[model samples]
Target: MPQTIAEKILQNHTREEVRPGRIVRCRVDMVLANDITAPLAIKSFRAMGAERVFDRDRVALVCDHFTPNKDIDSAEQVKTVRQFAEAMGVTHYYEGGNVGVEHALLPEQGIVGPGDVVVGADSHTCTYGGLGAFATGMGSTDIAAAMALGETWFKVPPSIRVELYGTPQPHVSAKDYMLRLIGEIGVAGALYKALEFGGPAVEALSVEGRMTMANMAIEAGGKVGLFAVDDKTVAYARRAGRSGNQVMAPDAGAEYERVVDIHVDDMSPQVACPHLPDNVRAVDEVAGLRIDQAVIGSCTNGRIEDMRVAAAVLKGRRVADRVRCIVLPATPSIWKQALKEGLIEIFMDAGCVVGPATCGPCLGGHMGILAGGERAIATTNRNFKGRMGSLESEVYLSNPAVAAASAVVGEIVHPSHL
Candidate 1:
C-alpha cells in the first residue's frame, strides 16, 4: 500500500502494517517534557513504580517555560524536574544556562532527526516534523508511560497534502503562509490529521522557515506537520552532528484525506487578530492600529533568521516612545549568535529590551505582561484571550519583520511602510 511520510515513519518504528485510524505501538526515538509539564509527568512516573526511564539517552527534560524562577511556584516546579533528571541520569537534561525551549533545543542538539518518533508533553513538539520526523504532543501521563516503556500507542492519522506553488514576496514569510492557511481552514479544519507540506516552494524554504510553519500546524488542529527529507534536511542534521538516516517520503500514489494548494507570489504579510489564530488578515487591512508592546520571539519565530530580520528593520530606528518592544532569542545559543552578529546592539540602540532565552511572556508567564486594555503585536504563535496577560489586553500575531516594523511605528503596519 502507498504510504505518506507519517505512515512510513510509523510503520518503520513498529515494523507493522500501519494505516490511518489503526492503533499501533511504536518505539519512541525521543521523549521530552518541560518544567511546566515534567513535574506532573514525574509524579505519574513515580506512581507507575518506574525507577528508571527505558533509555536515559532518549529522554529530555527542558526547563524553559518559567525558568529564571518567575516565582516560588515555578521554582518548585523546576526543582521537581531537576531532581527527577538527576535521579534518572537522563543524558539530555537542560536547565539554567543550558536550557533552550524544548522544541527548538531538541533539533539543535541532534536529539531528534529524520524518521524519528518523538512525543513531548507540549503541543509544539510537532515542530520536529520539519526535520522529516513523526512527532506529536501528548498528555503528561502519556509521556510518563512513554518514558518508562520507550514505546507509545498512536492512532495513525490521515494526511492533508498542502501544495505550495510560488515564492513569497519580500517581508512575507512562512508565518504569513501558516496564518493564511489557518484562516482558510479554520482552527479545526485539519483536526487529528497530519499536514504534509510539499511543492516547489517547500524546497525553496529554509529549514528555519519550515520549522516555523510546522510549529504552527497545531494551531490548525493538525496532529503533525511533515516535510519530506531532502538535501536541506540532510545538511541541517549534519550541522547538528547527526547523520540523517531512515529518511523517508510519501509514495507516488500516497493517499490523502484532502489536498489544498496555496500560491504565495502576491501574498502579503499576514497577522492573526485577538482571540483566535484563524482570525487572520493582511497587514495592510489593519495598519495604524496602535500597539502598546511589540514582542519578537518565542519558539515560533525566535531563530537566528528571525533575529536578523528584526535587526534589519530596527537597524537605526528607535521604538516608539510609548511602545515597549521586547526581543527574546528562544535559546542561549541563538542569543549568543545574535550578540555576535551585532543584532543585540541594534536592538539595544533601538530601545528594545533583549531578554534571556525562555518561553517567557508568550504564555503570560512573565517579563512583558500586558496591562488591561493594552495591545501588543508579537511574533509568538497564538493570540488567545489572556494568553500574554490581562484578558482585556489584545495580541496581534505576526512575523518578526512585521513585529519590528510595528514597534518602530507603534502601530500595526507592513514592513514596507517603515
Candidate 2:
C-alpha cells in the first residue's frame, strides 16, 4: 500500500507496515525537552531507575522558556536541568547564552532532520515537520521514557492533504495562510490527524515560513504537520551540516482523510482575534482597533526573514506613542545575525525593545506582559485567554509585517495601510 510522507517516515523508523490508527513502537531519532518540562522528565527518569539515557547524543535539553532566570522559581528550574545535564553527560544540552527556542534551535543545528522521528515535551515540536521529519510533541513522562529507551509508541495518524495553489501577495505570509486555514477549519478540524502540506505554493515558501506554519499545527488540533522532502529541504539540511540520507516522500496514490485547498493569490493578511487561534479575520476587518503592545517575535515568526520584514516596515518610522513594541530573536545566532544585518539597529531606532532569544511573553512568562483590559498584536502563535498575562487583556495574532505595521499606527492594520 502506498503511504503518505508521515506514514513513510514512521514505517522507516519502526520497520513495520504502519497504517492510520495502528499502534506502533518506533525508534526515535531525537528527543527534546525545555527547562519548563525537562525538570519533570528528569524526575520521572530518576523514578524509572534509568541511570543514563538511551543515547546521550540523541537527547536534547533546551532552556528557552523563562530563561535568563526570570524569577527565583524559574532560575531554580534551569538549575535542576543544568545539574541533570551535567550528571547525565547529555551532549545536546543548551542553556544560558547558548539557548534558543527548542523548536528553532534543534533544526538549525541539524539535530533534527529529514525522515527523523522526533519527540519533544513541547507541543510546537511539530515545527520539525517542515524539514520533512515525522515530529510530534509528547508529555514529559513519555519524553522520559523515550530518553531512557530511544523509542515511543504512536497511533499512526491519518493524513489530511492541504494543497496550496497560488502565490501570496505582498506583506502576506505563511502565517496569514495558516491563520486562514485555521479559520476555515476551526481548532478541532484536524484533530489527531497529520496535515501534509504540498503543491506549488507551499513549495515556494522558505523553510522558515514552512516551519512557522507547522509550528501552529497543534493549534488546529493536528497530530503532526508534514511536508515532503525536496531540494529546499536538502539544501537546508546541508547548510545545517547534516548530510543524512534519510529523505522520504509520499508515494503516489497515498491515502488521505480529506483534502483542503487554499488559493492564496488574493489572500489578504490575516489575524486571529482574542481567545482562540481560529478566530481569524482579514486585517482590514479589525483595522483601527487600538493596541497597547505589539510583539514581533516568537517561535512562529522570530527567524531572520521575519526580522528583516519587521525592520523594513520600521526603518523610517517609530512605534506609535503609548504602544510598546518588543522584538525577540528566537535564538542567539539569529540575534547575532540580526545585529550584523543592522535589523537590531532599525528596531532600536524605532523605539522597539530587542529582547534575548527566549519564548518570552508568548507564554505569558515575562518580558512584555499585558495588563487588564489592554490589547496586543503579536507574531506569536496562540491568543488563548491569559496566554500573555491578564485574562482581561486581548491578543491579536498576525505575521511579523502586520505586527510591525500595527506598532507604527498604535492599532491593528495591514502593512499596506502604512
Candidate 3:
C-alpha cells in the first residue's frame, strides 16, 4: 500500500475514482505545444471551430524545436504559429532560447505546479512530474482538443515503484544510476505505467539530479515518472519564485502493479550505446573509445548545478587537443546563473565553446556535427544513430562528469579517475 508521486497528483485531479483499465476524464490545467508539433495542434483546434482557446493563460506555445529556424520552411512555420497564437490572444508564448524546452521552461517558471494535469505535444512532458504534476505527453491532435475543452481522456496507467537504496560513488550522477535502472527494466518494461522513483538512493540525489532522472523517464517507455516533493522540492520552489505551496503526494495505501529494488552502493558509471536507449553497458567496458566532440547541455543536464560540476573539471585544464567541447545552458535563466557563479568564465578559459541557451546538439539539428563514421561522446540524452549531428556518425551517451573527463583525456574515462 505504498504511494507514488504520480498517483498523488492524479488523485488530486480525480473528479471520480478510476480503476485499472478504465478511461477517466480529467480537467487539464495547462496545454502546451511546440514548433515541431504546435502547427498541427493549432490547425486541429481551428478545425474544431474553437472561437477562442478555452483559456489564453492556460495554453503555452513554445518554439524550442528547430529554434532559430534552420531553414525557411521552419521559420515560416513558426511565423504562422506565432500569428495564430497572437490572434487567439495567448500571452504564454515563449520564443528563442529564452523559452527553452517546454517541460523545462514551464516548471522553471510558475506555470506548472503540484496536482496540475498538464498536457504537452512533446513526449518528454512527463518531466513536469518532478513537481508532482499529473503531466503526460499526448499527440498534437489530442493537445488541440484539450486546448479547446480543457479536458482530456486517459486510461488510468498502472504503476511501477522503483526503490533505489545506497549512496553514489565519487563523480557518479543520477544519469548513471538511471541508465542502470533502465538497463535492468529494459526500454519497454515500464510501458504505459507511471514510474515512481524512491528509496534512499533517490533521496540522496540533489533536486536537479532528480529532475534529470524524471526528465528522461519517457526514454524507458514510461507514461510518466515522478519523485516525492520533499525538502528538495521546497528548495527548487524557492529558487523558482514560489516560496511555498501545498504539495501533493499519494495515499498511504495506494495500490501499485509492481515494485523493484535497485542497489547503488558499488555501482559504476553507466552508458547507453548507439541505436537505442536500453542498450546499456558499464562505462569501464566502453572506456578509451575515441571521441571527436563532447557536448554538455540540454534539458537533461543544462542546469546551473550541472554546469558547476562540469566546470570543476574544465577549470584550469584544457580539453583534449583534437576534441571540441560545447557547453550550452538550458535556458536564459540558467545562462545568467552560470555567469553569476563564474562557471561561464571557467568554461571559456578551458577553451570550451559557449553556445546560446538552447537545446543545441541535444536534438541533433545543429552544433557538434561529426564526420561520417566519426565517433563522439556527449552528456546529452539518447545515443541513437544520428542523434548528435551526423547521419553516419556514431554517438555514446554518458553523464556530464564522464563527458568532462573524456574531454580532458580525449577518450572515455570515468570522472573519478581525475
Candidate 4:
C-alpha cells in the first residue's frame, strides 16, 4: 500500500488512502484559469448558477496568453476574464503589468507549493509538480466545477519512476534531457500516467530546470510529472515567499508501472523536430539546418536561469545576418532582474529583439510569426505543425543555450560550438 508523492498529496486532500485508477473526490488547494481558458470556465460557472467561488483566494485568474490583446477578439476575451475576476472579489487575479504565464507565474509568486493539489485550465499545469505539488490540467468545465466547489474528482494515475544519474555535460540542460527521454518513450508512452523524476541528475538541476522538464512532460502524454521534495525545492519555495509548506516524497516501497533510468553524462544537446515533440535528435546530427528565427521564452524555459544561459552564449556576439532572434522573459519580474544583470543588454547587443513578458511566438499568437517553408529554433515546448505560424513552416525545439547559439549561426548548432 505504498504511495507515490502524487498519491500521498491526493490522499491528504481526501483524508483516506487511495490507489491508482481509483476515483476519488478531493479538495482542490488551488484553481487556475488563464485568459484563453477563463472565459469558458466563467461561462460554465455562470451556467451552474454559482454566484461566488468556493474560496476567492484559492482561485487565480491570469490574463497572459492574449494579454496586451492580440486583436479585438482577444481583447474581448480578456475583458470577460477581468470582469469575472472583479465581480468574484478574486484577489489573485493578474492582468496587464502583472500578467505572466499562469503556470510559471503562480509558482514564482508562491501561489503553488509542496503538497498542494492544483487544478488549472492549462495543459502545462503539470509544471507545478516540479515543486512537489500534485498539479494537473482539466477542461474549462472541470475548472469551473472546481472553482464553485473547491473540489473535483480524479482517477488516480499509475506512476512511472524515472531515475536519473551522472552529471550533465556542459550545455546539456534539462530541456535536452527531457527531449531525449521523450524521444525514447515516444509521444504516447505515458498516456494517463505520472512521470516521477528522481535520483542524482535530477538533484543537480536547479528549480528552473526542473520546471522546464515538468512543463513538457505532457508532450509525452504524461498526466503529471513530479519530483520529490528536496533542498532545491525548499530553497526555491522560500525564495518565492512560501513558508510552513511540508515536503512530500514517494514511499521507498512505492510501486511503479515502469522505471526508466537516464545517465545525464551520456546525453547531448537535443532537439525536437517539426510537428512532434518526440521526434528528437542530437543537436550535432541537426547542425547546420538553416533557421529563419529563434525564440527563447515560454512557461517551459523562460525563467531567469534560461535567460542567463542565453545571455552567456550571446554575449559579445551578433545574431546571424539572416536570422531573426526574439527573447521573451516569462514575467515582468524576471525581465527586471535580467535588465539589472545586463542580460537584456547582451541580447540587444547581439541583435536579438527583447520582448515583453508574453507567450508571444510560443503559441504563434504574434511577435515572430514564420512564413511558409521557414524554419525556427525555439525554447518553448511544443512543435506541432503551424505552432509558430504557417503549416509549411518548421519548428525545432531546444534549450535556451542551443537556441541562442543557433541564432548566432542561423542554424541548429550545439551551444559549445559558439
Candidate 5:
C-alpha cells in the first residue's frame, strides 16, 4: 500500500526503515524555540557540554509569547530569550510586533516543508503538517536534544481515518467541526496517533480551513494531526511560495487503527465552554449566553479567510456598544493581504479593534485585557481560565461568524439571523 504524506515525512527521517508497526529513531531536520521554552532549551543544551549547535541555521527561535512586554515577567522572559538567541547565533529571530505567533511564523519562512521531521517546544508545532511535514511538539529536554544532536525517536503511531462526508450548511466553519470532533472523540481518545482526514467534506475545504482543523488536533490530544496532501495542499504550498508537487495520499486498504465518520449535513456551529476544549455545545444550546467580547485570530482560525468571513458578516452592521471585538491576522503576510482585500475597513467600521500581527492578547501576553467576571466569544483556540486576558474573565470559543454575530448583539446569537 502507498503511504500518506505524514508517513513519507516520517520515512525520510528514519534512521532505520522498519515497517509501519515498529518504533524508529529519526534524524530531525529542524528544531524550534519560542520565548517561553527557548531559555530552558538553551540552558539544557549548554549543560550537555555542547559548545555550539549541530547547525545554528537549522534552528529557529521566535520571540512571540511576550512581545513589547505585556507585564514585568513577560519583559524579563523576553530579555532572557533575546540574549540567548543572539549568543547562540540562531538565524530566525522575530522580535516585538514583527514577531507573529510561533506556529504562524515558522512555516511562512520556508524552513519547514515536505518529507521533513520537525520538532518544536510549543505544543501546536503540528501546524506545519499542512506543508506535508511530520511535525510534533516536545518538552524543553526534547528541544535541547534536537537542538544539539538534530535527532529524536518516535514510535510510528498507527493511523486513524476521519471522514467528513458531505458539504456543510451555510455559515458553518472548520472550528465548529473541530470542536464537535473533540466532543465525539473525547479529549484523551486520540492520544499519540495520526488522524488522516479525507472524503469529500475534507477535500473540499480550503487550505486555511484545513489548517484550522489540523491545528486543533492537539485539542483532541492527538500527537500529529494532518490531512492527506491533495490538490488543496499542493495549491497552498504554491501560493505560500514553497511551490512543491509532492502531495501524498494513502492506498485504499491502508491500515487504520480507528475510523470516525462525521456527516457534514447534521453538523452545526459549535461552542466550547470555559475550562476545556472538549466541553463542546451547539450554538443553539448556548443562544442566550451573554458575552462581553469577540476575537477572530489565532494559529487556528486567524488566517485571511477567517478575517474575510468576519468582515462579510459585520459590514454595514455596528458592533454592540457593550461588546468589544478584535481581529488579528495570523502573520504579517496575511495582514498585508487582508489590508489589500479591504477587510480591515469593514472591521474598523463595525467598531472592531484590529490588532497587529502578533500573538497579542491570545494568551494574555498583551492587548485586549478583560476585567473580573466578564465574558468573551473568541475565534482563537483554547479557553482555559485566564487564557485570553484576566484570570477572572470567562471565554466562549466559536466560529468567526458566531463570534461576529455575538459581537453585534452583545450576546450569543447565530450569525444566520442577519
Candidate 6:
C-alpha cells in the first residue's frame, strides 16, 4: 500500500490517503500564469465575480513568453495580466527586465518547494518536480479556479519509475538523458502518469540538470516528472534562499505501473529531430547536417551550466558566417550572473546575439525566427515543425554543447569536433 512520491505529495495537500486514479481536492501552494495564459485566466476569474484571489501572495504572474512585447497585440495581452496582478495586489508579479520563463523563475525565486502542490498555466510547470514538488499544468479556466479557491481536484496519476543506473559521460548531460527517455518511451509513452526519476544516476544530476529533465516530461506525455528530495534538492533549495529540509521520497515498496532503467554511461549527445521529441538520434547520426540558426536557451537547458558549456565550446570560435546564433538566459537573474561571469561577452564575441531573458524565439515568439526552408539546431525543448517560426522551417533539439558546436560550423556537430 506504499505510495509513490507524486502520490504522497498530492495526498499531503489533500490531507488524505490517496492513490492513483482517485479524485481528490488539494490545496495549492502556488498558482502561476504567464502573459499568454493569464489573460484567459483573468477573464475566468472575473467571470466568477471573484474580486480577490484565494491567497494573493500565492499567485504569481510572469510576463515571459511574449514579453518585451513582440507587438501591440502582445503588449496589450501582457498589460491585461499586469493590470490583473496590480488590482489583485499579487506580490509575485514579474514583468519587463524582471520577467522570466515561469518554469525557470518559479524555482529560482523559491516560490516552489518540496512537498508543495504548484499549478501553473504552463506545461513545463512540472519543472518544479525537480525540487520534489507535486506540480502540473492546467488550462486557464482550471488555473482561474485555483486562483479563486486556492485548490483544485485531480485524478492522481499512476507512476512510472525511471531508474538511472550509471553516471553520465562527460558532455553527455541530462538533456541527452531525457532525449533518450523520450525516444524509448515515444511522445505519448507516459500519458497521464507520474514519471519518477530515481536511482544512482538521477541522484548525481545537478539541480539544473534535474530541472531540464523535469521540464521536458510533458514532451513524453507525462502528467508530472519527479525526483526524490535528496541532498542535491536540499542544497538547491537552500541556495535559492529557501529551507530545503522538506525531504520526501517514495516508500521502499511503492508500486509503479512500469519501471524503465537507463545506463547513462552508454549514452551520447542526442537530438530530437524536426517534428517530434521522440524522434531522437545520437550526435554522430546527424553530424554534418546543415543548419541556418542555433539557439542556446529555453526553460530546458538554459541554466548557468548550459551557458558555461556553450561558452566553453565557443570561447575563441566564430559562428559560421552563414549561421545566426542566439543565446538567451532563462531568467533575468541568470542573465545578470552570466554577465558577471563574462559568458555573455564570450557569446557576443563569437558572433552570437545575446538576447534578453525572455522565452523569445523558443515558441516562435520572436528574436530568432527562421525563414522558409531554414533549419535550426537549438538547445531549447521541443522541435515540432514551425515551433520556432514558419511551418517550412525545421528545428533540431540538442544540448548546449552540440548547439554551440553547430553554431560554429553551421551544421549539426558534436563538441568534440571543436
lDDT winner between candidates 5 and 6: 6
CA lDDT, every prediction? 0.93, 0.93, 0.81, 0.91, 0.80, 0.90
Query: TM-score for every candidate vs. truth?
Result: 0.99, 0.99, 0.95, 0.99, 0.94, 0.98
Off by over 4 Å in 5: 1-5, 18-21, 243-245, 389-392
Q: Runs in model 1 with CA error above 4 Å?
A: 244-247
- lDDT by residue for model 1 (5-70), tens: 999999989976799999999999999999999999999999999989999999999999998889
Better of 4 and 5 by lDDT: 4
lDDT at position 221, candidate 4? 96
Candidate 2, residue 371: the lDDT equals 97
lDDT per residue for candidate 6 within 1-418, as digits (tens), equals: 7889998888788876698888899999999999999999999999998889999889999999887899999999988998888899999999987788778888988888878899999888998888898889999999999999999999999999999988776678999999999999999999989999998888888988998999999999998999999877887888888873666789999999999999987788998998999999999999988999999999997888889999999999999999999998888888889999999999989999988888889899999999999999988888988999999999999999999999999899878877
Tell me the deviation in Å of residue 102 in model 3: 2.6
Clashing pairs in 6: none
lDDT of 3 by residue, 1-418 (tens): 3545665565556676766566788888899988889899988988999888899999999887777777899898899789988999987898874677666678788788655789999887887777767788999999999999988988878888888989878778888878887888888988988888888998878777877887778888988888777777766776777755564556677778889898888889888888777888888988888888898887778887888889998888999898899998777788888999999999988889998766657777776677788777777777778887678988888888888888889988888776
**Candidate 5 at 40: error in angstroms?**
1.3
Q: The CA-based lDDT of model 5 is what?
A: 0.80
Candidate 1, lDDT over the whole model: 0.93
lDDT of 4 at 272: 96
Q: What tens digits encode model 4's per-residue C-alpha lDDT throughout 1-418?
A: 7888878888999965589998989999999999889999999999999999999999999888877788999999999998998899998999888887777899999999988899999999999989988899899999999999999998899999999889888999999889988999989988999999999889888888888999988999998999989878888899899998766678989999999988888789999997999999999999989999999998998999999999999999999999999998999899999999999999999999999778878898888899999999999999999999999999999999999999999889998887
Output the worst ten-in-a-row residue range by lDDT, candidate 4. Answer: 243-252
For candidate 4, give the lDDT: 0.91
